[model samples]
Target: MAASDVTVGVIFLAQIFVGSLGNSSLLLHFLVLDFTGGRVRHTDLILKHLTVANLLTLLCRGVPQTVAALGMKVFLSDLECKLLFYVHRVGRSVSIGSTCLLSSFQAITISPGDSRWAALKEKALRYMCSSTRLNWILYGLLNVMFPVVMTGNWSHRNITCLKDFGYCSAARHDTTTDSLFAALLSFPDAVCVGLMLWSSSSMVYILHRHKQRMQHVHKVRSPKSSPEPPKPSSSW
Candidate 1:
């Protein structure tokens, strides 16, 4: 039987529709801009690719399962099942990893390191799309096989794939293959989580310091800076 936790299911499904639509529209705008056959073109390509990935995520994961939840798991062949679930799984995983990589890359790019990438930061704004060619190619290929690799775990194992294509929540399978997939799955999540947390903390710290500096400036400029000399004269 196809089922999901009621309240949780409703909220998540809603999120899928809302978020996907908004992103798709933004992607369309970029597409309409006529990405010139340069680095600019690659930016559009990557963004368009991301949209397709998200669309695949919604189609292969969200819509089908939501329909199933409303009725039954119809229109599913064993092959379709594998491919559908595989596409959802891989596309989502790649999305997460890519986002993490993007954030970390930004942090590093802006870092004090005198590395080559840091030097390119000033020029990045002009050709933001061009810089991502290598990034898109490498990561795009790295995760291309994820869906294929996911098939083994989906069928021969008990790993439960989520409807939102966010992540899989599954019971343990007494098989090496399943375990291996789980490990592969967990590594990126762990690294992404750790890096995000660390990055967030640093950002928070910087903001706090900035706040203190502003407060110090205010203190220095305030009229109270020159403590009134006890109102010595007056009518007292």
Candidate 2:
């Protein structure tokens, strides 16, 4: 294998192993404690659903494809290759869409009242997994045509933004076409990342301000009462 391929292989395998184990534990947690037990309520269900979607993504894309990289040299039947390609591609895309939906929902939740999607605030705050129906629908719709849109045999996408190897690119020739697809692919992801970062940072700032206020209050309450000047010697 070429050094680059080897590097890809190693990195992919590590992600596979780690993502699989971590997601499995999360799945176990959801089933054993979150869902089955009465421990889950309200927003907890949303967390459970998100974890399950992520777990599905990891298993579908990470583990099998990682293993395939190790033994990819062996020639396979046409049907086998297509099936492998199809599963890996569809699964990864679904994973991406699902994760994006999860993050977007979170962002909507934390956004202030003046935000554009402020109407979604109430829905976002509630248990999205159980109380809200839209996220699941969005996840399904985002991925429904993936298998159709992608051609399994190409190995490379006809469209542009073809960075990852396993999945075919969307562009075949024109750089403009590729750039458009790249923008499409990146916009939602970038928004999700940005929203999460902003929301988390805002919370940190709020906490810092709160701590400063408490310190001020503490100082006010326990003013270092100055000792009285020493009395003149009474012996006089």
Candidate 3:
């Protein structure tokens, strides 16, 4: 094998191993908590979902690339390719949405407890599970086109217009169809990313303001240095 191929294989292997290990650890922790009747925080629940999604993404995307890089000639059937791509897409989307949800949740949790945001915070905490469930459902439906478009490498030879994805290929759609699908996929991702950024920025701003207020309070409450009484005259 070429040196580049060896390097690629090693990179993929490292990614797959490290990513799987970390995600699995988080998943096991969550599972143990659930089984032992431990109090699981709502944030933990979101992290659990994110862990699972990360695992799926690593396995689906890394394993194939690793095998290919190693000069392996494994062949996947059409069904296998479609299923793999579909699962990978869903996992990726879920990961993004989970991150966004987690950030937004934290922002809401830390916001001032005024009447304006009190109800919003309560609703966020109360519907955390429902929100996650809805996230999964929405993304699952959004990427439903994968199964229809994806095909095994073997089929790519016969298809004139196909986009190769190493272990699989996707049939090329016309410009209009491609544009429509691209819009559909990009819309949710854009929204999720935007929300994540906005929430993260809000948290930073809130923390900064809090820190300034703390400094101000500390300065105000700190004892002022009293002036020393007039010292005795120097030795005559």
Best by lDDT: 3
Clashes by residue pair, model 2? 157-169, 158-171, 158-172, 159-170, 159-171, 159-172, 160-171
Clashes of 3: 0
Better of 2 and 3 by lDDT: 3
All-Cα superposition RMSD per candidate:
7.0, 5.5, 1.9
State the lDDT of candidate 2 residue by residue for 26-108, as single tens digits.
76776787445646644445555556666656665665455556556433343444454455444454455445555556556
TM accuracy, model 3: 0.94
Off by over 4 Å in 2: 1-11, 35-38, 41-43, 73-123, 130-133, 153-176, 226-236
Which residue runs of candidate 1 sit more than 4 Å off their true CA positions? Answer: 1-16, 32-52, 105-174, 221-236
Candidate 3 stretches with Cα past 4 Å from truth are 232-236
Name the lDDT of candidate 1.
Answer: 0.58
Query: Could you give candidate 3's per-residue lDDT for residues 1-236 as a string of tens digits?
Result: 88998899999999899999999998999999999999988799899989999999999888987887877644788888888888999999999999999999999888877635557887898899998899889989999999999998876657799987777888997999999999999999999999999999989988998899999999999999999999888895
Clashes of each: 1, 7, 0
Pick the winner on TM-score between candidates 1 and 3: 3
**Native-referenced Cα lDDT, model 2:** 0.57
